[model samples]
Every structure is written in structure tokens, then in C-alpha cells.
Target: MNNTVVVAIPATTANMGPGFDCLGMSLSLYNEIHMSLTPGFINIEIEGEGAEDIARDERNIVFCAAKRVFTEIGESCVGLSIKLINQIPASRGLGSSASAIVGGLVAANKLTGSRLSQERLLDLATEMEGHPDNVAPALLGGIIVSVFQEGKVHYLRVSPPEGLNAVVAIPEFHLSTHSAREVLPKQVSMKDAVFNLSRSALLVAALCQNRLEMLRVAGTDALHQPYRTKLIPGMNEVIEGALQAGALNVTLSGAGPTVIALTDGEKPAVNDAMKGAFQRAGVSCQVKNLKPTVEGARII
Candidate 1:
């Protein structure tokens, strides 16, 4: 048996449109973790993304998540050495932390004899992340529709349709999830609730049926984005720009400083439009044309 395990975890975009706290899709970007057992010490190496900000000590999220796995199985792993090669941007609504948590869990599971089922690992990952939106896709891949109830995650994965892609415009500044959530209200009107519910259902159905045109209406939101626009300068303008450039739909990617557009045609134009909107707002941004991935975290 191999003593060392390397796991690759994909980045994810959560809360696609009106499906707040439930919908997400895995992207082509990935973070890889290389782990090996040690005698009695924990060693961690971080590269790329938020390397300077990520902790090297046991306080690190990856180490904490991995430790949780060891404790969960009642197995004593003396120590571990983990190297993270990260490509996902942290605090950009791109599921960077989710990738880290899932990476650590999957790598440690493999190192410890692969005792846990995917469902069990997902429950653990959701417990750590406080929600299943991001972690679900990072762990299971493709597009995930998830719900967390009674301390467990219930989810289903949707395979993306061919020829569809995402044009993501990621701004330079970091927007912490905590800060983003703090800006939202505790209660909303019934009319707003119904609005979001209808759209969320439509979004899921449209994705499933490969009816791309329906996304224009399905991606409209009344729950989070309306309030979140204040936190993200020029967000509405960015959405309009993408729409004008032939995007099927546009929405905030998680609790974003990033904006994403869904398109089956003119991807480059949509990318440019999003970037230009951000620039006009005096916000520096980078754009990436990424495809949805069907594969999730796995030992490689």
C-alpha cells in the first residue's frame, strides 16, 4: 500500500443565482494536496493563492480538517506532512476554503486506509464549512444541489450540458464571507421569498433540461443579490454588461467580490464586458473563461 497520498480538489462557485445556500458547480481550477505520515510532528507547506495568509501551524484549516478525520475514525495518526498547491483564489467566492477542507479530508482518508464513505466525508466537510453549498461541489464535483438538515447533507449532482461555460470576473479585493453575510437582513417579505423560490426551481430545472434560454429568468434573484449589490460595487452594471454581450445569465458567485456569467456563445465578449464594467467602476479585476467539471476530489 502507498504511504503517501496526493488528492486534487476542484474549485467551486456556490449560490448560482437564486439558489442561495444550495446550488453550486465545480470549476476546472484545482488545488492539490500531498500528504504523508510523519513520526510525531505536523508539517505544512503552502504555495500559490493565499499562501502568505494561510497558517502553517495546526491552526491551519487543512490541518484542522485532517485532524477531524483522524478523530472521527478513532484512529491515531501520529503526524502528517501536507503540501498544498493551490490555484483557487481565496475569499473571492470561488470555494478556495472548500477546496482546502475537502483536500485535507480526502488526502487524510486515503493515508489512513480509506475507511470513510463519500457520504460520511461530505457530512464531515459540511460540518466544518457551516454549509454544503461550496463543499458539496468540491467533494462531489459537477453541479450540486444540496441541503443541510439535522446535522447531515442531502445533495444531488447535475452533469453540465456540453458547450456551456462560465465567464468569471474576479475582483482584486477580498470580500470575506462573514462580512458578506453580515450585510444581509434577517427577514424578507413573502413576495421576495416566492420570487426566489420560483427562480431557484426554474434554474435547477433549466440546467437539468438543457434549456439554456430559461437561465435569463432563472438567474434573477430577490433574496441575496439585491442586498449584496451594495457590498459589490458596480455589480448591477456588470450583470447588464454581460447580458448585453450575449450571456444567458449573470449572478454573484457566492458572497462575491466576483461575478460570473453563464454563456454558450461569445464567451470572450462576455468576459471582456464583465472586466470592462469592473474597470469603469474603478475596481481592478481578472477574468477567466472556465468550464464546469464533472470530477471531484480524488487521490491521484
Candidate 2:
């Protein structure tokens, strides 16, 4: 077995409008993990974003994932050293946790003589993640549609069109997925349920056809977003401002505080408008223009 391995996993935005835990796409942003076998104890080092307060010991997600893979492969415990270079922000609807999980597993797989196939690795990852949408796209890239069915996983990839750019506006505050999910109602009205179902299908069709105009209707969600929007103080204003500023569509990114706007151009105007809305709402935010990553997770 190799003594060392390095893996890079891209950050992902899941449930890009109405897909809600079933759709996602990888972005260019990444978190990198390097692992090497040592003699006695587990050691960790972290740098870049989300590093300052993150644990540098076994409690780290990378360590946990690596340990899990090693145990699954029947490998004896060796001292392990892990260095994480994080570029993705934690708990902001970007797949930071998924990156750590995928990175560690990929490194562990490479170190253990590649005993796990891609399917097995993804299965392990989804199990660890508790959901496959973000992890699947982060590992596979492009636009991914996934569903867990009959004790097996099924997925398909579609190419994103050239004219669209993803404009992500990230707020400074953190919104835990747990807290965000807690806001959702236990039961939804049949009309609302049907509304989301129709929009979700429309969203898929719009993306497949690169029909930017259709996104205005397709991105509307009556299920989770309405309940969760109150958690984000200026969510409605941000969405409205971005759309009015020429965004093709706007939606919450993952479990966000991070709002994503889809546009036909670079959409600096839309980004600025969204930022202004955040500022008016007394929240600080940063905006970046990101393109869909064609490749997902990879060892380097």
C-alpha cells in the first residue's frame, strides 16, 4: 500500500432551486486533504478558510472518514498525519463537510491499494453524509440528478450550458443545516406539494434545454424555502433584487445563508444588487462568480 495520498474535492451547491436534497452541481472552489502514514498517533493540520477554530485531532471530519475507510478495508491502525487546506466556508450551504468526507475517503482508498470501487466509495460517502446530493455531485462533477432507490443508488450527469454563470452571495453569519431544517413544517398542503413537484420538474427541464427564461418560473419553491426564508433576514429582498437586476433565477444554496443567482452573463449588476440588499438588511456578505466544475472529486 502507498504510504501517502492527496485528494481534492470541489465545493458543491445542492438543491439549486427546487431539487431539495436531490440535485447538485460542483463548483471550482475546493478543499484539499493530504494523508500520510506514520507511527503512533493521529495528527492534523489545517489552513485557509474554516481552519482557525476547527479541531486538529480525531474529532475532525477528515480523520473520522479516513478511519472509517481504513476499518472497512481491514487495515490495521497506523499513525496518520492529515493536512487540510480548506477553501470552502463551513455551514453556509457550500459542501464543506462533504469535501472533507470525500477527500479523506479518497486518500484512504488510495493508501489502501485502491480496494474500493467508485460505487463502493460513493456508497460509503453517502452513508457518512446522510444524503447523497452534495456528495454525489462533488464526487462526479457537472450537474447531477440522484435518487436512492431500492437499497441502491442511481445517478445521471448532464452538461451545464455555456451562457450561464452561478453568482454566489455568501453572508457572514452561519446557518446550521439542523436549525434550517427545523423551520420546515412537518406537513405541507397538497397544493404546495404539487407546486414544488411541478417546479422541480420544470427546473430539470430548463437546465437540460438551457432555457434561461424558464428558470424564472422553475425556481419557485413552495415547500422548504418559504419556511426557511424567515431564518435569513433578507432572503426575499435578495431574491427579488437579483431577479430585477437581470438574474435568470435566484434560490437558496443548499441549506443556506448563501444565496445563488443564475444569470446569462457574468451578472455583476445582479451580484451588486444582491449585496446591497444584504447590506440593507444589516448583514455583511461576499459575492463571487463561479462556473460549474466539469470534474468532481480527484486524487492529486
Q: After superposition, how far is residue 114 of candidate 1 from its true place, in Å?
A: 0.6
What's the CA error at residue 32 for candidate 1, in Å?
0.9
TM-score, predicted candidate 1 vs. hidden true structure:
0.98
lDDT of each: 0.91, 0.88
The runs of at least 3 residues in candidate 1 whose Cα sits more than 4 Å from the true structure, single-residue gaps closed, are none
Those runs of model 2 whose alpha carbons end farther than 4 Å from true positions after fitting are: none
Global fold similarity of model 2 (TM-score)? 0.97
The candidate scoring highest on lDDT is 1
**lDDT tens string, model 1, 1-300?**
357999999889999989999999999888999989887998999999999999998898898888988998997768889899999999999999999899889988888888889899999999999999999999998999999999899898999988889888999999999999998999999999999999999999999999999999999998888888998888999999999999999999999989999999547889889999999999999999889999999778
Query: Deviation in angstroms for 153 in model 1?
Result: 1.2
> lDDT, candidate 2, residue 276?
98
Highest TM-score scorer? 1
The Cα RMSD of model 2 versus the native structure comes to: 1.2
TM-score of each: 0.98, 0.97
Tell me model 2's lDDT, rounded to 2 decimals.
0.88
Clashing pairs in 1: none
